[model samples]
Target: MIGSTSWVIPGTYYENALLLEGLVDFVELLVYTWDEDTKTLLFNEMDKLLQLDLSYTVHLPMDRLDNVIRAYNFFEEARFPVINYVLHPIKGWRRTLGEKVALENLKELIEPHNRMVFDVGHHFLGKKFPAHLKEAIVEIHAMGVIDGRDHLPLDRETAAFIKGFMGDLITENVLINFEVFDLEDLKNSLKVWSDTFVE
Candidate 1:
């Protein structure tokens, strides 16, 4: 399934997600630091989301693994069925929180078959998507980030390569989130995906 990042929806996080009811299969909630006030707001909105019965996945903050664990627990206790907890293999965090280690750590919080969200662009940053992790991938953050500039539109050659490499995995159940910030870029990226990989 194809989805857009919640950041480009131009509203409160919950409001933006609500707007995606019929437009996409799921919403990857881009979560940041959960300050006390923000945490309250999030709990309230999460209740609304549960009531609405929208399919969702959470994109945890890249800066903190504790936040990721906490978010997962909150959603689990709330009885929300999150598809995946997407993660980034941040620099300097490799020793303590590598992708595999994080997945293992998450196993203590969740089931053995818990899924993960993978970012394709992160592969270029020395964060390789290992063969072992492929079985647990339920969603993907798709974008083109070159020379440290992220959220840039996917270029033609890169788009073609993606179609060649990732097109086969475009099943109806797996979510491909266009994790770009600009609205136009998101739309264009969707079109590129549709034209190139959705056949």
Candidate 2:
């Protein structure tokens, strides 16, 4: 399934979700923080969001595990159509979170069989893309690391690599999120993906 980061236009999570409705298969909510205000908004907009097309996947907080637990609980209780939560591998939470979360690669390549949200930009920055991790991949954060920065649009330098790698990486079960923030980058990446991979 094709996905994009919720930061695409920067109005509100629900606003973006509504805007992205039908544009992609899912929208990965960039939940870097879990607060009462966020909770209230989600609660109020839950019904409206549920009525929209497409599913959801959340990018949980990269730091604290408590926030992760809190965020997941809300979505869980709502029975939201969240594909899976993408998290930077935290310590020992796997036992608790179980299959609900996909550990993303960062400083280390996590052990396989625990589902993963493979970030192409992360590996590109480090210049390592191991085939072994593919076995664990359930979702992909597809963006390019350009000029020492990650999450840039898929430019020519990275398009060839993305096409080459994704050709083998994509599958019926895997979700590919463009993961770009700017509208222009998202448009470009979507086009590049279609041009290079889809047709």
Candidate 3:
């Protein structure tokens, strides 16, 4: 079951995601805002999302590290059946929250009901984690940044590297979000992925 994000599907038709229910496996809902006041404003949208029959894996806000716990608490209180809680290995506070400390925090914070979203793009950005951390991963935000720009689809060499790195997880059916923001790039990347992995 392949999936894509809500932002790329063309139009302000987020709720119309149900239309693609047959065509796609799931819709990744991006929750980029996690402030308490903003969450109050977003309550209706959250309610609407919770009601959807579609599966979801939320992209937690990465603007600041402070919002991390709040975002997790919000989902916990809402009781949404989120497939995984996606977060970047944020390097912003690496002086204080180095990879080891950060991963330990995540291990302690996340409840058993939810798994983690591994962002290999951030890993490329110097936010490295131990290979053992793969145990907590259920979804992968799979893209590699070559230059400064991100969300770029993986080239053949990079894709091959990722396939070898991921190894058993792919065979285990762990969800992979291509992380391409544009529709055309997403389609092209899907074709590349199918050729390499699916086909």
Candidate 4:
């Protein structure tokens, strides 16, 4: 089951509710810089939104370790087996946060519950991304350029770079999420993957 990291559309929880009721087998709840009150409300709502007994993956709040710890505690208390924990280096305003600090904080915060979802976008943004961080994270989600320009939708150059980096850096058992918007973009991404990996 292909799980999407982003489910929330800004100012539209009803739309999110409608989408969640459909045929999605798995989901990674992308919490935005976790607030205790917000997390509690969302967790309660998720129980109602999903039709089947759903499996959960969490995109942890990267800003504060407290938020991450709260999420871990919530998952443990709820007995939800988190498939992965998606990590981002920076918190807000695209501010540069060192990867060493990020990784160190993550290790201290995360328990032995699930895998890590390392975002390539953040890695590139962070000036101090470490080689050892790759070893630490379980899965990698490659966020292609999202400039909303039709002609430059995750263009070949970026895809090739990510492909080459993934080939070299990623170890076995790491899953990759190609974050794309719309059907046309998805098609373009698939073609790139096919051309790069097959024939």
Candidate 5:
């Protein structure tokens, strides 16, 4: 399904979620920061969040396992039904929440159960997802890479690529997350995607 990152605008997750309720099929919750205020904001808004007509996938914190555990605990405690948990390869990382984790690129893991979340921009840096790993991709982080930068707003060419060679993941059912952080980026990406990336 088509989707956008949770922080499409500069706002709290709940605020962004509310803003994006009907705009996207799902919100890739950018659950990166771990702190009391962030916890309080999300916790207080959890009940209201359930009321929104939106689905959720979670991008767990990439750096710290403690934060990952906290994120998992938060979602589990909230009884959040996430589509998948996108994970970046981390040192000393192990399965924290069963097989729910969709291991992100930048590393190769050979375990049969190891699912994947492919980032198009990251692929620009190197290491395109191998054909053997096709079955493992559960999500696509769709965005652009200008110069040496990645995850910028998707231009028409990039959007076209998203549904073509640059994206064109084997799994047709996998989620296509805009993965952009700005509102204008999301708007442009969506329009360009719908216009050029015909299903």
Candidate 6:
């Protein structure tokens, strides 16, 4: 099943509860940066949410490298089968550090997870795409664009990219997500995906 990250509400737990109520077969959790104090609060909140028994996939925080590292370790230790981990190429450091460094770091961070959600927008903005990173996971979800921007809707170019990427990966059932904002975009994206993939 396809789902979108719930970041519309103020608190994570509250938004999560709302998402559960929506009854989507799957949901994406964007667990952003958390300090020690915040982490404690978050854990307590998560415990309450877990009581609901709603299954979900987590999107690791991308604010800082340390945050990503810590989140990865937490999920690993908890043995949580993370559905996908989102990666953002370090801004200014991209040119200097290179995509290889980011790829290595991402591999180390998500070794425990079996899947990944690749944000085509970020990769496009960074102008650094690591083809090798595709080999590290069993499932790859290409996040599509919205309007003229990436990570929103399935535009022509992004659709082509998905087709090409899927061909190169040769992985069965590679998930593609259109990060749409409105109902129109969502409907259009579904049509675009159907037209492109369905016979």
| Index of the highest-TM-score prediction | 2
Computed on alpha carbons, the lDDT of every model, listed in order, comes to: 0.62, 0.79, 0.60, 0.50, 0.76, 0.51
Q: How much does candidate 3 score in TM-score?
A: 0.67
* Regions of model 3 farther than 4 Å from truth: 9-23, 35-42, 45-53, 64-66, 88-116, 127-129
lDDT of 4 by residue, 9-51 (tens): 4433324435543433345666667676767676776555444
Measured with C-alpha atoms, the lDDT of residue 82 in candidate 2 is 80
Measured by TM-score, how close is model 1 to the native structure?
A: 0.73
TM-scores of all predicted structures: 0.73, 0.90, 0.67, 0.60, 0.87, 0.59
TM-score winner between candidates 1 and 2:
2
1-199: candidate 6 lDDT, tens digit per residue = 5454554345665454564444333455566774686466556666555555454566556687777667666766765545555554443323222121222133223222223345566555543445666655433344465554555656667777766775656444443434544434555666776677666
Model 4 accuracy (lDDT, Cα): 0.50
User: Per TM-score, what order, best first?
Assistant: 2, 5, 1, 3, 4, 6
Lowest summed lDDT across 10 adjacent residues in model 5 is found at 106-115
The global Cα lDDT (0 to 1) of model 6 is 0.51
Highest-lDDT candidate:
2
lDDT string for model 1 (61-111, tens) is: 656766655665666677767765555544333333323222312211222
Q: How high a TM-score does candidate 2 get?
A: 0.90
User: Count of backbone clashes for each model?
Assistant: 0, 0, 0, 0, 0, 4
lDDT of 3 at 181: 66
Residue range 1-199, candidate 2, lDDT tens digits: 8998888886888888887887788888888878998788878877887788878888887668788788888888888878888887676567536567887877455545558777887887763656766777888888867788988887766777766766666787998888789878888887887777765
Model 6 error, position 2 (Å)? 3.2
Least accurate 10 contiguous residues by lDDT in model 3? 96-105
Q: What is the lDDT of candidate 5?
A: 0.76
Candidate 2 wrong stretches, greater than 4 Å = 107-113
Least lDDT summed over 10 consecutive residues: which range in candidate 1? 104-113
